[model samples]
Target: MGKTLDNVYKHQSLVYKYFLYVVSVALIVFFFPKGGKFKYEFQKGKPWQYENLYAPIDFSIHKTQQEVEEEQSTIRTNKTDYYTYSSTVVSEVRAEVSNGINTLFQTEIFTSSQRESLRNLSEEVLTDVYDHGIFQNMPQSRGTVVVKNNEAQPIAPNDYQNVELAKKAVTEYLSDANSYGTDRLSGIIRNNLKANLFYDNVLTESALNDELSKISYTRGEVDQGKLIISKGEIVENEDFKVLSSLRDEYESELWMGSNYYFILLGYTILVALVLIMLFLFLKRYRSDIFLNNNKVTFIFFNILLMVVATTLMVKHYENFVYMVPLCILPLVLKNFFDARLGLFVHVLTVLILGFVVPNSFEYIFLQIIAGIVTILTASELYKRANLFISVGQITLIYIVGYFAFHAIHEGNLDNIEWVLFGVFVLNGLLTLFAQPLIYMFEKIFGLVSDVSLLELSDTNSKLLKELSDKAPGTFHHSLQVANLAEAAANEIGANAMLVRVGALYHDIGKMENPTYFTENQITNVNPHDDLPPKESAKIIIDHVIKGIEIARKNNVPDRVIDFIRTHHGTTLVYYFFKKQQELDKDADPANFKYPGPVPFSKETAILMMSDAVEAASKSLKNPTYGIIDAFVEKIVKGQMQADQFLNANITLKEIEMVKKVLKQKLTNIYHLRVEYPE
Candidate 1:
């Protein structure tokens, strides 16, 4: 049991890596829609590429979205308007007219015969107006109106009388009376006549909705085993509708039964394969990241974030899928790592998403192209303009690619969705968030980016300024080394920014004992003259340690701190060791060496070479071109013999390149003019 526990502890890192792979795969698969994919691919106005397809099951032919919208629009335009007829209003108006006529007659305004004639004419006018059904608010246009009384009845637009029409009818009836009180009688009838019909908004909307609900989404049905379309046949309007319906039905019903587990298994295997590809890529091209569990987790976390975001958008708002800023993945990765790894990871992520997004071919193509553009155009993210330009280029590509696909599908640019271009632009704007995201990742992961490197490389920074004030000679040495290392890094395709920053901070430990070092000695007095050889050696070795402490206190990232740790790389402090050996025959050599883990990357290794060569070149009395070249060669050769770069992932060819850069730079610095032959 003890041995078994020991084995588990020994392989804990491996076990953790496998656990990450499993968890990432499981989470991604869980978010995927649990529907079976359609077995065939077809596009409207394009030839069917697959074999002839037949309906596997009996299914109703569903209408296209455009077709359904047109039907609904037609229904809305021609729907019947409903109005309610008020019987109580008619009775009240009739009684009021009769009462008014009686009151007028009691005043002796009319003779008995005139009073009788007025009452008869008023009653006749009231009956005629009520029969026509005066409307409280008439319809704006002539159309069929359903009037609900005891039972709902359809009425023509002319059948309903408005107030003006009823008043005209009353006036005409009075004119026919030819009585003394015709005008007064007419006024009584017209004033008492109130509109009995009113528009019924609630009933109208309800009836309209009923009609809309009755709209048939399915036009016809296709029977099982019926040939839907032949191979190489152009998918026209009718064929496209039938094919779409079958695809929908097949996917929806395919996973409803015992086939669900199979579908889930299929999804799991595909997700696992894609993740495995990403793992293999890191292991093959970026082994440094693959070995560190934290870095590995960082990469996987980014992938999962994109997948979750895209899946949620698809599930809730499928039409807005283009709005997601997928290119941000490549942008962030390229800033943190390199362009190659960024594009690789981006492609793998898009491939996984292709399984879920609509138009698998189009989605994968657009995303891959955008990833390429990000890699090609986005550089120096510390500059704000570069990010904006890159995002604009990516958005433009999206618009152009989608336009091309749309034109291909529809055979014209007439039906292109202009709103989708806005979505693409929004996508570009969202991609601008990658810069802040990179800063946040650096903090969370304890990693440094080019932006951070650029910030640290500033000589006017607090730590560098203190180094300048306390140890001006060492600060100058650091600046020279920074220049040399940056030039060499650029020549060999290494991280020039990182190496430059590392070179600037590598000698910060010298600030602790500024006068003890030769470079800081501005006076004739030498501090080393008062100290023992062993103590001088100890002080020299302590700088690397002191630099680390100061950097951490200043909240420097671990990546930069690595430079201070391994710049000396376990090499012997030869001057003090030789002096102590002359004094004592048997002196301890272990105390004279700088404790180091050695440079383990190209950038750090370049710093080590540049730091040693640049400091040693200052001792030349009368420098010449050949002398300076040989001197640079000797220093680099000595360091190589000491195996100071044993752990660094640098090649012999790259070392030769660095030597050439250093040689040219030293000759330039010393002004070693070539001799002219007269």
Candidate 2:
């Protein structure tokens, strides 16, 4: 039991790494649609690239979506409108008319005979209006409509009199009967008349749906072992429809019953292989990131996020698949890491996504190209215009690549999908969000980005400004170091922005006691002269500790604070240590050394070289090209011999490159140009 627990504790980090890998693969595969992938790739109007395909089993050829929709639309447009004749409404209106006339005649302005004549005339008008049928409202169809009473009958548009027409007929009939009060009788008839025809919505809808249901989704059938298409044959309209139908049938039948588990197993293997490739890449080239579980988690989390988003988009909004901002993956990664890793991860992500998206080749091609553009152009993310320009370039690449694919597929520009161009534009706009996303990721993951480094590098920032005010000499020294380190980093393809930021804040602890440091001692009196050698060494060594405390108090990222701890590495303060050794032969050397964890990255390593070279060059008198070159080489070689860079992931070749850059920069600083031979 003791041995088992020991083994578990010893390999816990390895266990956690594998746990992340397993979970990422599971989540990605879980979101994938449970359908078998069709092995062949094809496009409308493009020639078949594979061998001749044959139907392995009997399947029907389905109609295209356009054909199906057109047929349904034709049915709806020509569907017959239905109207119902309500005899009950006619009966009630006629009875009301009779009662209204009798009540009006009771006013006694008319004789018995005059009353009789008005009642007969009113009856005749009502009969005429009712015989022609007063419809409830006009039908939508202008053609003849089917009217249902006890049975159905087709009625012409002219056969029916709506309420308006019925009222007009009543008015014209009583035009010559003014002596019998034409206005009074007309009002009574118009008020009593009601439309007896009403539209039958239920019957019309049923009939239309019945016609639509009769539409044949499948137009033809392919027998078993029949040739579908030959290689090099252009997939015309009919061939496209047939091929699409076969693909659907093939996938549906392939991923059913016991075959489902096998298909799932196949998917798991493919997904695992892709993720394993990513793991291998990080392990091989970026072992620093791989060993740090938090960085590994951050990378895996981004990959999973992109996969889930694309899976949901493809499942729900397949038509707008191009609208997804896939290029943001490389953009964000490039800002946080480097271009090579970003593009590598982007390509891997796109390859995995190819399993879920339709037209896998085209999607993979477009996304990989856009990702390459993203890595190449998305430099200097702290500058808002750079991101904007990068996003624009990415958008242009997407549009151009898609246009080329479309031209290949359709053999013309005439049928290019203009809406996808708008989708590409929208994708570009969403990519602009990568800047804010980087900020959020920094806060959540405790990682730093170039944008944050840019913010920290600002000379007007609170901590930097305090450093400038309290120790102007140290602040100027930091600035010079920043320029030197930045140039060296750029020369060796390291993170220049990171090295610059580190250099600017490396010596902020000198602000704690400005007078003790030689750079800030403006007057002739040296503060160190009065102090004991041991005490002076303590003060110089305490600056690194003081700088870390100040940075933590000011909420500086730990990545930047690493510079303060590692700039002098484990090297001793030679001036104070030598002074102490001369007074007593038994002085301890521990008191004079800067507490260090050593530089662990190329950026931090570059800062160490730059900080040391820039400070020592101040003591040189009458500097020249040859002298500066030798001086820089001696200082770097001494540090190298002391193993200051033993922990750093830098090559000897890179160290030499940094030395070259520092030498050239120093010569320029002192205005020491080479002399021409006469």
Candidate 3:
């Protein structure tokens, strides 16, 4: 087991790990909602282009979403809602009223005989009111009174009220007595009587739910093998109902039986095919990325992340799928790599989602167009305004594609879902965050981007500022190298921003011992004259190492640090080395060479040549175009013979282009042409 674990860590196991990765991704995608796709695509108001359709199995016609919702609303409107009547409340209130009447009669305002008569009159009237069945006031003047043991009795709403009804009853009862005493008796009843009946919320809700459960959701059914619809039949309301039901029953039949495994297997194979195609493309063309596990993982991670996001949206938030920022994946990938890879991954992701999202054709079509727009427009992420413009274009494409598909499906735009357009706008706004996401990717993956390169190229940054303040001559030389390298990079379709930034910070180590280098020596009294030739050579070689350390300390990107390490390309300090050989013919040559893994990229290679040519141009006494041309050729040829650029992925033709660009730029700097008479 330990040996197996060790083998897994070895570089030779990369292929196995990649296989495991692909399998894991395929399995995850398989677990998502890969609903069984209908054999033919159909839309409302469009003709059925397939052969005559017949029911394959016995199934009931199902309702559309709108129909189901409307049926539910109608049932809720007509459903009998129950309310519980508390018998104990009526009895308790009757006793309280009797006691209140007795207490009122105890006052001196009533004599013994009068008190006795008043009690009799109140009791008789209250009894008549209680027999009427007090109930809660309800809308439409009606309510179902739920009694004990779940017996529901309907009653009028006016039954439950204050003592005014009781008082009226008492007034008629007292007609036989004197009218003068009846007025005084009604005042006493009004002051003491209060409402007793209330609605029981818990029982009402339970009973209402019970009634709702009894309502049948499936209204009607169709026999097995019934003819549902024929080919080329316009899907009117009734036809849509039959088709919607057929789809539901078909999906249900597949899910409940063993047939779904086949569907799942098909989904897995399809997703795996797309992923494998992507891997093959990368391995064949972008082999550098293919070999690096981290880069390959980064690309796959983004694709998987977007897939998971889309699947979740489709499953739970089908309506808000438009609100997802699907364009972000292509935007970020294009900024990091190229437009082709970005669009490729985006297409694969949307295709996987097509199986799950409702209206798969519309979803896939809109996202594909948006992804294309993102790739075409979102290139320079360093410019903040570029992302805004790109996002706007992506949003516009989404809107146009969505409406066009809607128009095709509906045969008109009058019923278009305008809310989805708002969602698309929100998606575009979210896409604007891709710039910050690129920064995060750069940090987490240790990858550099154009945005970071642009920030580094600024002259006021800490590292560049220090180089300028402490070693002004090296700083000026770096500026010239930047211009020369940028021009050359543009000529060869290289990363101009990266090459320019690299040229700017290439000689930062000279600030540590600025005077030791010839460019920074402002005095005739040279510091190197006081030291041995080997020691001087050591100082020159040490700058590359010191520059790396300083750059790391200051948080420079690894790509920028490449220029610092490879600008000299392991070449010997010829002046100091020759001087050392004169003193001791056996002096070690290794001590004079810069510690370098030579320029491994075109940009770094360009920086090396540009740095050499620009610094050499400074030493010419009688400068002319011919002198500049010869100087450029001599420096570039010498470096080529030393094989400095062999590992840098630069071709001979590209090197010649760089040479030509350097000569032109240096001649312009020196004003080598004949001066016009003033």
Tell me the TM-score of each prediction against the true structure. Answer: 0.94, 0.91, 0.86
Most TM-score-accurate candidate: 1
Each model's RMSD to truth, in Å?
2.4, 3.2, 4.1
Query: Candidate 1 lDDT, tens digit per residue, 1-678?
Result: 999989889999888999999999999989998788887877788999988888889999999777899999988888877778888898898889888888888886667777777777777778777775888777764555656556677777668678988899889877987778888888888888888888888988898899999999999999999999999999997898899899999999978988898898998999999999988988887898999898899999999999999999999988889899999898888888899999999999999999899888889999999999999999999999999999999999999999899888888888677889889999999999998899899989877888999999888999999999999999999999999999999999999998889999998989889999889999999988898999999999999999999999999888899999998898899999999999997998898999997899999989998999888887888988778778988988888898988888999999999999999998888877779989
Answer with 1 or 2, whichever has the higher TM-score.
1
- TM-score computed on alpha carbons, candidate 3: 0.86
lDDT of 2 by residue, 1-678 (tens): 999989989999999998999999899999997789888888888899999998989999998777899999988887887777777887898789889887887764888887788888877887777764777776767554556456667777677678888888889889967756667888998998899877888988988889899999998889999999999999987888888899899899989999999988998999999999999999999998889899899999999999999999999998798888988888888878889999999999999999989889899998998898888888888888998999899999988998888887777898677899899999999988897899899999999998788889899999989999999999999999999999999999998888999999999999999999989989999988899999998999999999999999998999899999999999989998999989988888888887898888898999999999999999999998889989999999998998999889999999999999999999989998777879
Error of 1 at 575 (Å): 1.2
Tens-digit lDDT track of model 3 for 289-331: 7877777878888877777787787778888988889888988
Q: What are the Cα lDDT values of the candidates?
A: 0.89, 0.89, 0.78
Cα miss at 186, model 1 (Å)? 3.9
The per-candidate count of clashes, in order, stands at 0, 0, 1
Model 2's lDDT to the true fold? 0.89
| Segments in model 3 whose C-alpha atoms lie over 4 Å from true places | 1-13, 16-20, 78-81, 96-150, 156-180, 214-219, 233-237, 413-422, 490-493, 527-538, 570-595, 647-661, 671-678
